[model samples]
Target: MADDTGHTTPTRRELTGRIGVGLVMGLCGVLFVSTARISGGESIRDESGSVAEVLRERGRTISDLTDAAASKRTRIEELTQGTSSSEDRSQLVADAVGLSAVSGPGVRITLSDAPTSALGSIPGVTPDDLVVHQQDMEAFINALWAGGAEAMMLQDQRVINGSAFRCAGNTLLLEGRVYSPPFVITAIGDPDAMIASLDSAPSVKVYREWVEYVGLGERSEPLDEVTLPAFEGSLTVDVARTG
Candidate 1:
C-alpha cells in the first residue's frame, strides 16, 4: 500500500480486509477440491449395477461357449484323425486339458478378510481396510505366474490365458461364479520360488502391512500333490480387429 515516494501505508483496516479476502479464497479452493474428490469416489461406488442379474447372464453365456468349444474340438479331432498332424492335434488337446487340470507339487494360498469384531476395534481403520480386494488377488496371482506356475486354480476353477477376475463390493466374480472368503488359490510350480515371489511382491508387501496392523487374512503353504479341475466355462475368442 506504500506510494512511490515512500509515503505511509494503507490503514490497518484495509490490510485486514485484504487478508480476510485471501483466507476466504483459500478456504473456497480447499472446499472445491474436497467436494470434487468426494464426488469422484461416489461415482465409482454407484456405477456398478444389478450384480445378481449380471452374474446370471454371464453364467448363461459361459455355458453356451463351453458347449461350442467342446463341439469344435470334437469336429477338429475327427477331421485330423488320420492326418500326418495327428500328433500335433493330440498335443493341442493335451495342452487344453492340462490348462483345466494339472496335478503336481505346488503352492497354496489362502486369504480372507479380517473378522468384523477385529475391524471394529481398530482405530482409524475403515471397512475397506478389513476386506480382501481384487488388487490383492491380482498381485498374488501375478507373482505366482512370474514364479513360473504351470497352472493355477482360483477356488475350483482353472485359470486360463483369458481368465479375468473381478470383485463387486466384497464378493469375488470368477468364471461366472461368485465366491466369498476365505479365497483359496492353488498353483502348480516350484513351491519355493512361488513363495519367494509372494514374499517379494510390492502389492503383497502392502497387503501384508495391513495384515499386520489391521488383521487382513494371509497364508501360503506348499502342497505335495494337488490337482486343479479343467475350466468348464466357455470363452469368446475374437480373432478379427477393425479400425
Candidate 2:
C-alpha cells in the first residue's frame, strides 16, 4: 500500500495485529513488575516450605512465653522477699503451702490392686481391671479436696499443688520415686464430709463397683488424731502465694 511519498503502506489488518500484540506484551510486563515489587524480591514459596515456616514461628512463640513465665516468677519472688516481718511471712508460707507439719482429725483412705488369680476369677475382668489406676487415686484426692480438706498426704509425702503420680503396672511413680500397691492418702478434714464426698463421686462409685466385682482393695477409716509430715522434696514453686 502506497502513501503520498510513494512508499508501500501497511494494510489495516497488519496494523491492527501489531497494536494488539504490543498491548498484550505491555500488560504482561506491568503484571510481572507489580508482583515482584509486592513480594519485596522474595521468591513465591510453595506448600513444602509452609509447614516448616509455621513450625519455626510456633517454636519462637513458645520460647517467648517460657521467658515471660520465668520473668514473672522472678518478679514474684522478689516482691515476696521485700515484705516486712520475715518470720510471719515464713510461717504463712509454711502453713499455706504444706511446708510444715499438720495434725488434726481426718480420714485415711487406702487403695491396693487386686490379686493375680482374681483377674481370671472375675467374669469381665481384664488385666487393667485388677490393679489400682492413677485416675482412681486422683478421684479420691479430688474428692477430699472437694470435702474441705486442709492438709493432705499421699503416701509419706505431703500432697501439694505440685504433687503428681503415675501408674506403672501395679506400682506408682510419684515425683521421680516409685512405690508398690497399698497407696495411702490421709486428709485432715471432717471425716464425715470426706466420706460423703467419696461416696458421691461418680468415679468413686465406679471404683467401688469394680472392688465388689474384681476384689480390688479399698479401705476408709476415720482417725481421731492424725499427723502429716511436711513435704521433704525440693520445691521451687510458689503455689500458695500465687493462688
What does candidate 1's lDDT look like per residue over 143-220, in tens digits? 999988989999878888878889887888987677788899999989999999998999999999989887888889
Q: How far is candidate 1 from the true structure (C-alpha RMSD, Å)?
A: 13.8
lDDT scores in order: 0.84, 0.83
lDDT, model 1, position 153: 91
Model 2 worst lDDT window (10 residues) = 46-55
Provide the lDDT at 184 for model 2. Answer: 94
Which residues of candidate 1, in runs, are more than 4 Å off?
1-50, 53-87, 93-100, 238-243
Top-scoring candidate (lDDT):
1
What is the TM-score of candidate 1? 0.67
Please, what are the lDDT tens digits per residue for candidate 2 over residues 92-122? 8989988678999999999998887976676
